[model samples]
Target: MIRGIRGATTVTSNEEEEILEVTEELVNEIIAQNSFLPDEVAQVLITVTEDLSATFPAKALRRFEDWTYVPVMCATEIPVPGSLEKCIRILLTVNTTAAQNEINHIYMREAIKLRPDLSSTKRLAQ
Candidate 1:
């Protein structure tokens, strides 16, 4: 079965470095929490808020040499009034046997507000 795993994170600035660093951290946490291997990921859809134009969040995956084989696309998020700024969101469609309820969705930084109830209470690494 194919399951969608969701993860979101916020960058401190519009700089490319900050965006890449935070995005990579977010993806790492998602895969770690879900026990997903790169080969199991069929597609990755990444989006950033309107204020973040310095870089695409997908670029962060380049840090992982094995992740190059996974398909990744980036887009701009729909701007809504009072929405979080500098946020990057990812929806990963993976081929896995895990039940939907077993999938762990990660929300970090200010983006945690997007899914407070689903977000884990585990302390995040600095």
Candidate 2:
């Protein structure tokens, strides 16, 4: 069976390091929370809010993890009149036997405001 885990995070700045740090953190958390093995991940699709374009968030995620074999693609998120800024979102599809309810979705920073329900359900690291 295949399952998808969703995550979103906001960057404090558009700088390369800041983008890289936050993207890596969110991706790592999503993978850990679901106990997803690298080999089981089918692909990762990422989108960054229109205000962010300094660097591709996927590049940071790939470089930060031992997921050289995993496929990742990134694009600009659709711009809305009053949407959140400097945000990056991810949809990770992985091959797993876990049930839908077992999957963990993450929302952080300003992006947390986009989905308070999911954010409130998160189990953050101690």
TM-score of each: 0.93, 0.92
lDDT of each: 0.88, 0.85
Question: On residues 17-126, what C-alpha lDDT tens digit does candidate 1 reach at each position?
Answer: 99999999988888888887899999999999999999878888988869988999999999999899899999999988999888888999898899987675442431
Local lDDT at 56 for model 1: 78
Model 1 gets an lDDT of 0.88
Q: What does candidate 2's lDDT look like per residue over 1-126, in tens digits?
A: 998889999987789889999999898888778887889989999999878888888887667556998899999988988999899999999999999987778998888888887872455542
Clashing pairs in 1: none
Q: Each candidate: RMSD to true structure?
A: 2.5, 2.0
Choose the strongest candidate by TM-score: 1
Looking at model 2, report the run of 10 residues with the lowest lDDT sum.
117-126
Off by over 4 Å in 1: 122-126
